[model samples]
Structure formats: C-alpha cells, structure tokens
Target: MFAFIISRLLQALPVMLTVALLSFAMFAYVGDPVAIMLGQDYTIAQRDQLVADLGLDQPFFVQFMKFVVNAAQGEFGLSYRLSRPVAQLIVERAPATLELALCAAILALAVGVPMGVYTGLYRNSWLSRFFLTFSLIGVSLPTFLIGILLILTFSVWLGWLPSFGRGDTVNIGGWSTGLLTWSGLKALILPSITLGLFQLTLIMRLVRAEMMEVLRTDYIKFARARGLTNRAVHFGHALKNTLVPVITITGLQLGAIIAFAIVTETVFQWPGMGLLFIQSVAVADIPVMSAYLLLIALMFVTINLIVDLLYYAVDPRLRIGRGKGAH
Candidate 1:
C-alpha cells in the first residue's frame, strides 16, 4: 500500500507540474496586471519598478521557475484585484466551497443510492418509473437554471430559504463553517440541491445500471440457487458488487462537484472559491487565477489517487490479484 501510494504520488508530480506550467503560461500574458494594479496615475518609472518587482522583466522560464518554487511554498504572490495574498483569499473562501461540495456529495449519495437500489430491484414499479423520470429532469436541466428555479420557488415564492450567501458562520480556529448555525443550514439547502442534482441523477442511473447488471450475473443465480432469501441475495451479495463501480463514479463526481460548482455558485451568489474565481476573472487577477487552477488540479489528482486506493477496499478481487502478483 505504501509503495502504491508512493507510485501514485510520483505519477501525480508530472501532472501537477504540467498543470502549473500551463496555468502560469496562460495567465502570465492575459492582461496588464501592472496597469490594473498601479492605475492611470502611475509614472513610467513606477511602472518599470512595478514590473521589475513582479519579475515581469525576467525571462519567461525564469519567471515560471520562480512561480513554481513560490507555489511550492504556498505563495502565489499578491492578487492584483483584491490586493491580498492569493493563498489567504483561497483559505478564507475554501471552507465555503468545501462545505458546499461536502453537502452536495452527501445529498447525492444519501438520496441517489437508495433510489437506485429501489429502481434496480423493482424495475417495473410505478415508483421506479417516477424516479427515472425525475432523474431525467435532474440530468437535463442546466445547473444555473436549476439554481435559479430553486431560488425562485424556495427563496422568492415560498419564502422558506435564503437566496444567497454562506449565511452565518462560526470560526473554529480559523476554519469558518456554517454547519453550526440554523440559518447556515437553511441557506445550504437550495445551493446544495442545485449543485448535487446532476450528480445525484448520474449516480442513481449508474448504480441502477450496475445493480441490474450485477443481479443478472451467474454468481447471483448461484446465491439464489443456494436458497438464500431475496433480501440477502439482493442486498448482501448484489449490492456489494454493485458498489464497486459506484465508488469509482462517486469519487470522480465529488471532484467534479468542487471543480464545476462555478455555475451554481454564480447563480446563488455563494461566497465560495468558484465565486471568488469568477470575481477575479473580471480584472484578470493572475495570481488568484493561477492559484485556483493549481488548486483544482491538485484536488483532482488527490481525488483520483483516493479513488484508486478505494478500489482495493471495495473490490476484494483487486487485493487478491495484487497478492497473487506479489507471490
């Protein structure tokens, strides 16, 4: 397991470097951060000094190497727009994005898995058909549209939930969280649902399909032939196997939730990293943009590594295969 982890980390190194290089290259020339930062009143000498201070006058590779080294130490310089350290801004906004993503992932798994199980087990049932139809809506609608519709229904029309913001939060050792407050929880509902809806449908459909496929396998027939109860054969045997693929999809979808929460965040005006990134883009905040890019890439790599590790836990066959190969 240690070797596997080390190997995965080694694999991730190049990917991270590639992402860092690409992000730096792309954002480096996007706009005149000097002009944006110094404003119209600055003299040419001041501009030159600013450019020198920012290392803009250096060779491209030199600047890129500096960026990589700085980034390694969790420094992305200063945000041109916000005039704050990019890392600090990310730290402040990260909790909101992570919290929102966590809630969305929970909603997707909690609701999707059961719905999928029921649909797979009772494929001909009216409830199963209804779930299928509902899933279609969840899958078909765009995230922003869903968020807006939800805001209209729940926030505007029903007046049950707040439309925007992270609501009230309590800072615990510099980690701000809304989970402790009633208003915070309420505020989370619509955005969480909107962000998770597509993932929920995707998970449900994947689970249902996997479940159905697993149920038809010869092992399932053998289990039934052994006079196992329907519940035992279905849940104990088939569901366990069904979850192998579900775990993989769920892991990837969780990463997707964080990466693609931009649309939902925009619609709901959630004060998460996605919203921050959007705000930064208007002025071409390179530090924030590059940092966001690197962070997202890191998250994806980490999630993929975790998912690979989980395969050994979920599917014993992987462990057995590894053991055999070792021997």
Candidate 2:
C-alpha cells in the first residue's frame, strides 16, 4: 500500500508541473492583466516599467521557473485586480466551495444509493421505472439550468430560501464555513441540490448496474436459497459487494463536482472558488487563474490519494496484497 501510494504521488508530479506550465503559457495569449488594469491610465514607459517589474518581459522559461518555485512555497503572488495575495484569496474562499461540494456529495449518497438499490432489486416495477425516469432527467439536465429552476421555484415564487450569497458563517481554524449555521444550511440547500444533481443520477445508475450484477453472483443466490430475507440478501450482502466499484466512481465524481461547481456557483453567486475563478478569468488575472488551476489539480491528486488509501480498508484482497508486497 505504501509503495502503491508512493507510485501514485510520483505519477502526479509531472501532471502537476504540466498543468502549471500550461496555465502560465495560456495566460500569455489571454490578454494582459496589466494592460487591462492600466486601461489608458498609464504612459508607454510606465507600461514598460510595469511589465518589467512583473517579470513579464523575461523569457517564458525564466518566468515559468520563477512561478514554479513560488508556487511550490504557496506564494501565488499578488492579484493585479485585488492587490492581494492570490493564495490568501483562494484559502479564504475555498471553504465555501468545499462546504458546497461536501453537502452535495452527502445528499447524493443519501438519495442515490437507496434509490439505486430499490430500482436494481425490482427492475421491472412501476416504482423503479419512475425513479429511473427521474434519474434520467437528473442526468440530462444541465447544472446551471437546474440552479435557475430551483431559484425560481424555491426562492422567487415560494420565498422560502435566499437566492444568493453564503447566508451565515463560522470560522474554525482560520477556515470559515456556512454549513454549520441554520441560515447558512438553508442557503446551502438550493446550490447543493443543483451541484449534486448529476452526481446523484450518475451514482444511481452505477449502483443499479453494480447491484444487478452482484445479485446474480453465486453467493447472493446461495444466500437467497438459504432462506435469508430479501432485505438481508439484497442490502446486507449484495449492497456490500456492490460498494467497491461504487466507491471508486463516487470518489472520481467528487472531483468532477468540484470542477463543475463553477457554473452552479456562478448562477447562485455562492462565493466559492468557482465564482472566484470566473471573476479572475474575466479580468485576465493570471496569478489567480494559474493558482486556481494548480489548486484544483492538487485537489484531484489529494482526493485520488485518499481514495487509494481507502481501498485497503474496503477490500480484504487489496489489504492482503499490500501485506504480501510489504515483505
């Protein structure tokens, strides 16, 4: 397990470097932040001085090397637009995105798993068909559209929830989260639902497929022949076996949710990394944009590492292999 973990981490190193370098190079063609910031307010010499000061006049390789060194130490430089540390901005706002992602993931698992199990257990039932249809809709509809519809229904027409902003927050260990507060949770509901819709559908389908396959296996058939209750046979045995692949899909989906939440956050003004990323892109804030890309890459790497570690706990075979490999 340790060797496997080390291998995965080692593999991620080049990918991270490539992502950072690509982000840096891409910004060169995305229009200049300095030019946008100055906006006819500065002379040619002043512009040149600003460019030189920012090291933009340096060779691309030289700039990339500087960026890589600084980024390794978590110094993402100052945002041209905000005049603040880009890393600090990301740190402050990351919790909101994390909160949204986590809430959405929990909601997806709670709803999707059981629904999938039921559908898989009774594939031809009318109720199963109904849920399958709903899952189809959930998968088919785009996230921003869902967010708008939710806001229109729950906030605009009903006036039950706020349509925008992180409503209330509490700081813990320098990280502020709105998930813990009543008002914040209420505010969280719409966006979380919007962000989680696709994941919920995806999980439902995966579970249903895995459960159906597991049900046909020898152990499940034997369990049923041994007079075990349908509930115990399905839930206790089949579901447990179905979870290994489900876990892998769920972990990958989580990373995807964070990546795609940018749209949902923008629609709802959720004040998370997505919203911040959009705002940064609009102004050609290279520092923030590059940092955001790198941060997201790091997040994907970290989540995959955690998921890999969890495999040992979930499956005895992997654990046994690890033990043998250690020798």
Best by TM-score: 1
In model 1, state the lDDT of residue 3.
79
Local lDDT at 255 for model 2: 92
Using lDDT as the measure, which candidate wins? 1
Candidate RMSDs in Å, in order, are 1.7, 2.5
Per-prediction TM-score: 0.95, 0.91
Report every candidate's CA lDDT. 0.92, 0.89
lDDT of 2 by residue, 155-269 (tens): 9999999999999899999899896899998999999999998999899999999999999999998999999998899889999898888888899999988887899999999
**What lDDT score goes with residue 190 in model 2?**
97
**Model 2 ranges with Cα > 4 A deviation:** 27-29, 33-59, 320-322
lDDT of 1 at 8: 95
TM-score of the candidate numbered 1?
A: 0.95
